[model samples]
Target: MLNSNLLRKLDMQDLMVFIAVYQQSSVTGVSEALFVSQSTVSYCLKKLRTSFEDDLFINTRTGMRPTHKACTMYAHVLKILESINLCHAGPATFDPTRQAVTFNICAPEYFEHLILPRLLKNFDFADLPVIVNMHKLETDIPADELRDGSLDLVICFGPNFHRSHPDFKSQVLVEDDLVCVFDKRATPLEPRFSLQAFVERRHVFPTPWTSTTNMVDGWLARQAYKRQIVARANSYSAALKMITGTDFILTLPRRIQKLLAKDTIFNHCEAPNGLPGFTLNMQWSQNSDPDSANTWLRDQVLKACAEQGLS
Candidate 1:
């Protein structure tokens, strides 16, 4: 067992430093995040190392990585910090028009394009003096960060949401069907887009999922067919651009077609039969659900969806 005396010497600040270093993997990052000097973070780590009797983090080429012991200790340390935060967090009485607050939300890039404007407009209309931050989301949910309150909300595809995580609650925001965009001038128009024609065309695949594969590919594989993916684009419009004036095709959410239809060269067709549509959902941890600030922030997004007629 660790020496009880040394453990008693460890303070909340030291634990906070430890958690920050673990998450960021850089002393400089922890220093900046915690508003402390690098030396101060180093000093806290030194004290923590003495108490734990282990080098919790080790420097490597990429960054400082947590040791096995440190990895195991992370959950316990996080619980301690969370419990402390709960003790100090009394009833939240907030006024959006008067109180200054910050809301951090993570979602795919298209959400920004489609919903952010309306959300911002609503915020401005109310004269709410608050900061809004939108972070680009990855395929994997940042469950730990959400549970610990670092991430206020997450918006992800329905299939990608971690439904098994009991601590999270989710609501479907929108359901979108896929539409294929290509240069009508170059490719012959068929009333029906056959699966064979779809698999035969060169494709500019949209990504941040996988360079070579995605859900569509998985479906094609199950049917013993696959598309020719020639290039990868991070954005749907970029993918459409690559396929413009050529036989290459880009399949993306139908919502984007109207926005890009002004480009007379491009044409849209319904995705091939048997392909499934997708849904986007808004998710939040139970820890944040009851917070007045988070509730108001969610209201803005819902209003934005209503503006888009996404009921």
Candidate 2:
């Protein structure tokens, strides 16, 4: 039933070129994106057409549009490319001290306060050429970005974040409870902050760029209680600064409290009971899990957490 000659006519490189052309929609765009020449793209497209007996892509004023047959074959083509990649993936052996590779990670700004610093310190043990790129954690970080090799790892919080993406494998890095922060000069905490006082005080809440809701506000809403938010800021550092000269209070993760405690201007207490805590987790694409380099990175993170006594 199979045509041996037809099978022989197809090349893996031609399939890859076809995929690039289909996704980019322009010969020039494919060339630029894939680091190939336009002539090469044209030659491949010509071969593809001759084999399939159809013009896979048509040039128009807007861009290169895929023919109906080409549109139907797009998903299959992607799978083929993916299978080829998996087939060619070598064993997961990497030397962090010698391998010249860059690792990209994404996490929230709050992580920059404690976790990130410790993680970076762990990397100092390796004397090899290594580059670490950090990206801001977005609320809607696309699963495809991780799958496509754009990000190596993600450090984030939640009970539900990334639950929808089955391709992401996550491990708990730390569990942190909420704490109430106040200026030592303005708010006097003889023992601990009372629930009544916690709700009555003017709050300086840090609102992340991706969402309007703050962590403290969400917990309060669940209890049918709402604090008087005097102001909202985008950075936790800014919120901490605001409470320094005023009676406003901030409720954030306990790790942050410890990080800022040495400043002496701010003091923190346990957040009132009933408020929810969060789990910080490290996630990586399952496709990258087999790579020895990614395994090394994961181990380093866990080591950092252990050094901080979070494990």
Candidate 3:
């Protein structure tokens, strides 16, 4: 059997006063401990006794003594107080080494290839594993994913990207320009190719991952030029492989060119005719803007970029 009316009258403050009186053995003692006046403690104690329908404490020759009911309720009240304290304390500090946190980052294949190795090499994930799920950037910003917490962050090129989502926060992670790559064995022995020679070569161009328009072609179109495309590949790796043992040349980001050319025999030079460069930026939902774990993840990325000289 429960007392509904008594439940309404009882509150956290009442419980605190009763607990303080029980522990301190006197209202005046409770007042001194809690830095409240003796009258305030008495008022709350009176309410608590009315709520319980019991003389919760009685004055004795030595001190105030808790009744049987008060003694029975003391443990429950202490637990409730501890829970209340926890609730008001805010979120705990994030410890990556102690807590497992998975970070979801979206990027194009090129950005993934360039950043993943560097990020893993620099981050010290010794105790607890930090998982990173990398997804390819799409033609449109995944606003629903960002809002709903399905995705944690995105890194991609295009300054105008994510402009539609005002709640999305973004920072430039790296800047890179376009460069032309071709097999050193097949390319003409020249310091640099003229714009005419650049356009004349059979090009192995990479198709954009999520868009129909080729970014390289779009850039060339703005300058009233077009390349003789021999084939189109879906990713930078595919495009890089297609040009191997052939005269076909691939135009790609300078950083990506350097990374892919590490093992492969390739010659690279600045793209002819002053091709446009792009900046890759990292974006996260403002919903996580104040989250400590997300902030640490972003910092790790910035550190990786710095180590790679991309920042």
Candidate 4:
């Protein structure tokens, strides 16, 4: 249980002081980071201690060390403070043409390959100072990142993860048909995929946890079809690399196929008659802040995709 009064009394300034002290292990370091007097930093520390009913920090030869309780509470405190800061910072009034802002995005590598080139071409980040950090969908928890303010947005397939998190807002950005890719030189007798061919062929698939894989398997099961999954990888870049000059056929979104077309290492074919298309969505967390910068970012993405004639 938490003390609501204590929580209500804390603010971003307090957390900033706490984090600076925690990191540099000294009140002087905190004062420098916050551009405040040492006494002000010391005063904030006292308030934190009184509110939490904990020593929180202790002086040591190393400077100041956090107590075990402070260590345990660090992450939660940091996230809360960040949320407060974002809300208060107001709608990023900085003009996209003249201001600089860093945004962190979590997405599949294939999504990155498909969108990055167009995003850079359409949006002039030179003045905006934009930085994108791409993380593997399979390796990171995007919803958690969005909630904690570490991730500004997520572009991913399926709604499973975001559907349950109250803090997130999601919209279907595009719906793409699944296509099978293989070496163009190695053509099978059938121009279109067949259930028997699907089951018999050596298949390379993005990792089973990927929304595409889950949707494909679910569709196959509905149609009473099952394929031998020969390989599972987290990224299409990895899976496609594996399929080069080989007979392995991989099922992926058409957008991914178009992106890979540049490499000429493999070519794409349509899935057998029964498999269904999947929708890719963009998600962001909701904050009380009046800043509509996040919405602007999402609009920019959609506009970029439309300009490229990619739905």
Per lDDT, the best of the predicted structures is: 1
Prediction 1 TM-score vs. true: 0.67
Residue 119, model 1: lDDT of: 85
| Winner on TM-score (1 vs 4) | 1
TM-score, each model? 0.67, 0.67, 0.72, 0.62
Clashes of each: 0, 0, 0, 2
lDDT tens digits by residue: candidate 4, 243-308:
788888888888877776544566666788867777767878776223466766787788877877
> Candidate 3 — number of clashing residue pairs?
0
Stretches > 4 Å off in candidate 2: 1-92, 161-163
By lDDT, is 2 or 3 better? Answer: 3
Per-residue C-alpha lDDT of model 2 across residues 157-259, encoded as one tens digit per residue: 7776444577789898888888888888765554567677789889888754355465677777888888898888778888888888788888778887787
**Best-performing candidate as measured by TM-score:** 3
Task: State model 4's lDDT.
Answer: 0.75
lDDT of 2: 0.79
User: How displaced is residue 244 in candidate 4, in Å?
Assistant: 2.8
Candidate 1 colliding pairs: none
**Poorly placed runs, candidate 4 (over 4 Å):** 1-92, 124-126, 139-141, 159-163, 208-213, 262-265
Model 4 TM:
0.62
Clashing pairs in 2: none
Clashing pairs in 3: none
Rank candidates, TM-score, best first. 3, 1, 2, 4
